[model samples]
Target: SPFPVHINRQQVVHISGECCHCLRLNNLGIFRIHCHGQRGLIEAKIFNLSVGNHYDIGQKISFQLLESYEQLRQFPLEIFRTSLTILLTAQLRLVQERIRDLIVEEKSGCAIVSFQLFEIAAQLPKNEQVINILRNLIDKQAINLIDPNRRILHAICGSLVIGPKGESIDVKLFSQANGDYIGEFTPKKIGQYRIDVTCANIPIQDSPFFTEVYDPLQVHIGPLPKNILIGIENTLEINLDNAGNVPLEVIITSPSGINVPIKIDDILTMKKVHFTPTETGIHYLNVKFGSDIVPGTPIQMMVNNAHIISAYGDGIHHAVHEKEATFMIETKDMQGDLQVDIEGANSVIKTTIDRINNSLLKVTYIPVEVGFINISIKWNEKDIMNSPFTAIVTNPGNIY
Candidate 1:
């Protein structure tokens, strides 16, 4: 007698028997079996099963079959059962151990993320297919990409080309000859960017990678006056912006090749450098921020000659007709002989100049008129302080 049993197509079923012969009939989708020298019957029913496209990894597919036999002489019937299970999995594996984060400058052309891929089995699909799988996984948005500050959750994988300010950027994917994958994109703004990688819809180890972009430092140098006088203290102001919280180094060189001391006040915002030039020529000021020189640096200043300090006269304000008047002159850093001149209303008053000291000059003159008296003092043709001094000449009797 024959017993009916059902089994799933392509599922293996075990039939246990000693000295039993079994034959597969491909045309009828059944197995023919015979027991040695014994009257036996076999019946098999098979059902076709289709696999769904949404299958997950490690999912199990199983089927079972039951068989029963009745003895020819009315012996007790025997039953047997068999089952099989198949697990679904892919051959893709992440070969690279760790992925590092990236750092880029603002307006940088591109950012690249590199990784390696290898297969778990030797009989897996070709490398092209594996690459396609990776591409498809990325295209399907299986990986999460975002900018936390912007609060944006990327919807498309390739479309994750945005800067810190939500600006459009260009992105690209590369296939390397050494079995490595590279993802690249250009950043228009500056900030932190995060990228996550996944394989077979599962997050890869060290999945999220961080990238930081920053803007370069900007600097500006002095508003120095075109003409700077010698022997006078002058202030050089340097306006530094975007110093980026770093200490600034500044240097000033005089025309005599002497380094001038500089003082930086309000270092963070406005910086000031005060220097007093001794010699007269073009002076150079060099300013540095870290290892780079600031823009418009090495400023040139035209230093002119020295000027007078003070000048006075004795008895010149109310000079007598026949009395002698003495005039004194003081200059800053003047060392040469001084030339003195005195002129009356109609005649030139004769005067004698005496170098009392290195920076001092004395002149003695006799007033011959009752009008205004003009005294001129010079050192190397340059006027001393108040060189053209005026003195009133009144009557000797009316003088106080």
Candidate 2:
């Protein structure tokens, strides 16, 4: 006999399963489970299990079956999760590296230009308006690539180049000083070169000035003593002519090759030099310049000033503080008269001198003439010292 009962109204549904001690194969197998709440139906599969040595909950499963299920489900899922984590980490690292590179590049550009956005946006090819604005700025001399302190005013990590034929591009600001800038530079291999202009960690843009180096001025030795005797003091006169516009400092080296400073009053003109040589016997006279001298022009000379003038000539000339002068005396072996003229002065004194002894003779004053005091001595006819022993005469006022 079965009693009809509504599980929902009773709030319970009970099902009973066979105990582990049962022996019959299908002899009255009763499975039972208690159901509650909104759904009161007991499911038969909830408590179904095969009879084993121990109760189903306490049964020990084989390692092979457990390991197979783990490999097919949990183990594979764990491995897949680990692989996904590794891939995500690698992707994050790559993205970080790219971001770092971009930051470095941006910093480099910012170090040259004050406006970061201006430089970055100006580089884009699609920004035609920006390019045009930059062009106009250059034309208006609004951008300066050089500073007043002789520093190169750089753009955003780059240099400017001018072609042979094109509009005059101004890289300097309008308030900058106007001057000529010439640059002729070339790299061995074509590559990008960075230019940076920074002041107090901030960047500034100015004019682009260029410089070139030319052939240095050379020293040509003219008339000098070929053989130098030892233990004798020699006087050397170096003639220097500046061939370049740039002023240069002359450096005369000694026996130890130590450079000594030489004064240059004016570099664009010729200069006369006079110095005494200490050592003899083929001493090397090395001359250099602190700055670049004139290119392809005679800049210096090394020669003995003593060999050109006689040691007794200064005494025979007079008390006149005049430069070395040449005189012409006509003597036909007997006697003759002469005339004298002075430059940059109104006085001229004519005097006769001995041919063999070269003693001074009495003379009178003359009218106004050039500063050059020229005197002519004459005899009958005789050749002395290749031409004549004509000597420079001093002004009467210069007599002591």
Candidate 3:
């Protein structure tokens, strides 16, 4: 077989057909055979092109042998490739793919007043046309994408977002420091919203995006305590009648400016937030439903330095062997386990504590031997005010 072959490197080849028994190429990379000839003037088709076990997908395609001296009324083989499934899929026309590039930087779950942001990135065009131009270009790295020029925010380009109730929302688009365009808008009502951003009057990829607009402010939280005691675990409840869609975030900062962990319960129109204070000082509390901070947030809580406990009574003055001595403790509205310990006794001294009221306790101790006994009054394992009192004890007979 003998024919004048003109090739343009990869996908196209211009050749005039004289006659063909077999056309073979060896020890080379991918190649394509494009046909140019006078149509209906005896179709210049390659009958037998030998293929190897490992060959380019181009070989599986039938390329027409093109000749200069030819003209045809109709030619159907304008473009041909075996793997055209991808080309014919959404159509071979170049399309703007900016929807996946849409970046959302949200501030809150769509509350009564909600604002959201989306970053419009450089648009990418996809199609067979784009692939064809890229394959032949010399400087492979020189391919540049077309800028959107803020088309998604343009009023005429369909950037005017229609709200759920036919309310038109104004989308404010601005460029960031990194050259990214950001579009901001607020949902006018509580419902589903369709965001169909376009460029050059054509919808971008993933156009007509659907999202649910919810009002996180519908939930109600109970009043938060302004003061709490250190070392105590407290629980705060929130009513979630219409607030279960969004997440609740609570963060507590200690006086030393360290974040404290909090416990959260499920929504029941009821969410219990539990936190324990380890440090004694003022703490800051914050609660958020979605990205929206609840009404009562950044609350200042003062944990009063440990309660002042006062002790007084005749029991601390004297004791008699085998006789009970009495004392009274004024807790000053404090809370904890009341404890009384008696040491410096030869035998076991029986001690009893009776709660007279919320802030007072009666401590009674019966000594088994006579001597000087050491009295220690402690609350929650720590010694109370003026602890380790010394009392004089004598035998029952000597007491007379």
Candidate 4:
């Protein structure tokens, strides 16, 4: 009697048979037959067995078993063979179903690609030998697979970073103890970057990854004031725009070679610095963000050296007609030429200026008639302190 036995694909079956004859027999003929489902014999092995001897045979067979009665009744041998072939083929197929979380930071040039490899049947092997081989491929040929001219173009493996002049850039690879692979490279330029990865001589899904590289600290200093006054507390305000969150070192030197005190305040991406210059001259400012020099650095500021301290005279309040009124002016380290003028209603007043010292000046004016008189003074073609002095003029007899 023949009995049906079910076995998985690639499973080995062992059969042994021994013959006993009534009469003493030297040898006995034996035939081992294999069939798939209800189909006729598909394979056979013949052997000669001696009396009281046993013969054993082991064979690994696939696509030669029955699974269901319907399949046996229908295409019988064909269905069994097809089912076994499909199972065997699936067991031998290697598939990379999902590649997860591929990330790259352009500024840091760090890239990570994580994926898992398994059989088509979703079966994981106990050993990760296949994963190791795939990792090696990703490490060696990943960049090459994406960029064939990597050597000539200087393309970094797993990353796309070109120099300022489109030159090749060097990239460094990192070893990961985990199953994930990571590649790192410092980009020399700022722009969009792409990373490609390959595993087991095959490109993963969405093989090329993209990212944007930008300067960690982007700085912009506002336009400097063209002119600054001297001798008074003058404030120079500069607005700094910092895109990156980093501490900035700001230094300002006055024209007199004195360090100016600076105050910095942060409000979101905008940074404001207030600088007060004590001396008058050309001032320079240097700004840096973590050792990186800010654009438009070493800004220059011009400080003008001219101001008035005080000015007062007798003619400032009252002036006599046809009489000379004297006035005195005091300045702080005054320089250049000085001029004085006086004018009244329908009356011309002659004015004379005398420099008493570098910091002092005397003015005398004679009014022709009694009226309001205006006194104008200039220093170096510029207005003096308390310039355009007004005076009430009246007849000498009218003043009691």
Candidate 5:
């Protein structure tokens, strides 16, 4: 019989057999079976543990019996205990050794897997990395941005004095191929510094950027007469010395704070602006110089649209100073008549005598081609006070 098969979890059963010849001989088999989940496995061995029989401690045994004996009744009780002890000892040793091996294998597997996954191949940081560095630069305040190409670097924070490992190292902020940023921070002092800049959100890592401070050059509109007498045109001369490479803007402001119209002559290198007073009062002159100008490059003389008298040379560096004559005209045409014209402070002809070139004077008739032009003048924003001068004109003489 198969031992009734009623045990669960773990069970041990013994099967004994005998032949009719030796009634006292008994053969025994021991089985240790276990069922876990829905699967079961069993370890079985047969042994003759009779006190008088030789039994090797480590030997394989079988369940087949050659003979049976009547004294085998005692065989069940003695052999049963002996087989149980041997099976328990062997199972315990095998399970303990296997559990330890599994633990060791699991730990070793994790270490090996990590080593394979995180190896650093020789490579550099990319554009994205560079962008991050720029962002950090702004946050740390290493530089300030006035415009796209203009920036100022902080003296102390911007330098890498000591190296990262306490050894002197070279530090540079550069752009990479992929646009990533890699920093070579040579830390002289063990401290943190910030880089700040003023610009739009877009980054300018690989672009052309320069760090230099520009100062504006000075210009003078020259001091004018404190009191501008009415009926006199006040003449003001403007002067500028190129303190910087960039050209500066020179503007003259009226007493009303409006920009006064003036004549600009761009001479050799200095730009000269001549202003005639329209009203009498203390006037303000405002001049602004651009910092982009090259140092010591002066804008000699610049001309405005107002009045043009005599412009000597091409308005290049060291051009001849210009001169304009403002005077009243008395025209005597071929018809022999005298006419007077008042020239005001306007940039154009203030007032021209109509048909004066054809007018008749005294008892003589003046032709349109013959006349005497008269001239007179007053200084500053004043009226024409002097008598007019004569401009002579002669008629055409036929040759052939």
Candidate 6:
């Protein structure tokens, strides 16, 4: 007869055969077969004591007739149990019906298997040799829906760490109330750190990630000029000497709530931010470092339009014909091109300008053709205060 069936759980069965008979389960060293003979009938069971699910599998149990105790020659059970040259077949055939017993799949980031299967494999009697041979082709299994509460084994887990080379930092890893896993690490120094994750003595997917540490406190911003002029290039310098490799953000808002475009240049070791204010009113400046506001940020700056500049000297009023006319211009901290225009002169008017200092320039022009020559001076494309001075020119007719 084929092997008996066990479903959901394990069952023990009694076996009796004709006199001088023997039973053997071939190639199943793991399956412990218990045999005992009484008078004319022999009794034996081939398999371990176990409990499983939906396992109505019937395997062929080969039987062979042997000379009774007379053939055993006393102590039959001992001698026969040791020298029972039993060679059984290792073939799995559906003794009767074709049934779908188990379904193997992966779900929820985990491999799903019958919970009862592990129970059977880990049973007592310690049949390691046989179980290993037939582990993949196990006896029976049940196709059950996934149930989180019936977790009999470990749910795939891993560990994560972030630190510098050969130096580990403190990391806090926890699960939130919403069941989301979160990780945090505090770096002690400003350097590159490696993130490692492992599971079951093996590296998990995407094991290593890199990160850098930065200190926002080391970022410093210099003082901005409280007063600035419109249409003039004003610059602010920022010092990030001790700060790590991080980014700095700056925003300049005009009086009309418009964001002014600013140019940032790296000058030696400092950052120079240059912006030209167009509106004459109160403007705001914003600065930040890695989502943290730097000290003295969002400062207030008053903007004033360029006013008329004053000019004086002998070159603008009276001059002798064919003589050089000279004048001095005070820039008053103003910036732009220095221009000079001479009118009422038919001949080309030659002009010369020499920069004496940061805010002073010397202007010279010679008038060959004279007719009340009008002179005009403009700074930054705009005329200065009291410009277009008229100069009297008279030819020195036949000077001695």
Candidates' C-alpha lDDT: 0.45, 0.28, 0.47, 0.46, 0.28, 0.49
Which 10 successive residues of model 6 have the least lDDT summed?
19-28
TM-score of each candidate structure, all chains considered together = 0.29, 0.23, 0.33, 0.31, 0.23, 0.39
- Tens-digit per-residue lDDT, 1-400, candidate 1: 4988888554221222110111111111111222222221211211111111121211111111111111111221121010000000221343221111122111112222222222334534533464555455556655333232322232224422211112222434343354333444443333333343333222333333343332224555555743455776667676654333334677778767898766667755677777777878777877766445666777777776666346776654557675787866776554454677778888798887787877676778788888888877765555566667788787758658
lDDT of 1 at 61: 13
109-223 in candidate 6: lDDT tens per residue? 2232211111123333222332333332221221111122332222222211111113444454443354233444444554344444333222333434444444566767765
Per residue, candidate 5 scores C-alpha lDDT tens digits across 42-110 of 111111222112211121111111112222233353343344333322422222211111100011111
> Which candidate achieves the best lDDT against the true structure?
6
Q: Compute the lDDT of residue 75 as modeled in candidate 2.
A: 27
Give the poorly placed runs of model 4, Cα more than 4 Å off.
Answer: 1-173, 176-218, 255-257, 267-270, 306-400
Which regions of candidate 6 deviate over 4 angstroms? 1-167, 175-181, 202-207, 223-227, 266-269, 313-400
| Lowest summed lDDT window (length 10), candidate 1 | 79-88
Off by over 4 Å in 1: 1-218, 225-232, 242-244, 308-400
Query: Looking at candidate 2, what is the lDDT of residue 116?
Result: 12
RMSD of each: 29.1, 37.8, 23.6, 29.3, 39.5, 25.7
Model 4: per-residue lDDT, tens digit, 188-224? 4444333333332122334333433334345666645
Worst 10 residues of 3 by lDDT: 19-28
* TM-score computed on alpha carbons, candidate 2: 0.23
Most accurate candidate by TM-score = 6
Clash number for every model? Answer: 1, 30, 5, 0, 92, 6
Query: Which model is ahead, 2 or 4, in terms of lDDT?
Result: 4
lDDT of 2 by residue, 221-329 (tens): 3344332222233333334432222223444444555443334334234444333444322234443332433333332333222222111333223324333333333
Please list the residue runs of candidate 3 whose C-alpha ends up more than 4 Å from where it truly belongs after superposition. Answer: 1-204, 207-219, 223-227, 304-400
TM-score of 1: 0.29
lDDT of 5: 0.28
- For model 3 the local lDDT of residue 273 reads 82
Q: Which candidate order results from sorting by lDDT in descending order?
A: 6, 3, 4, 1, 2, 5
Clash count in backbone of candidate 2: 30
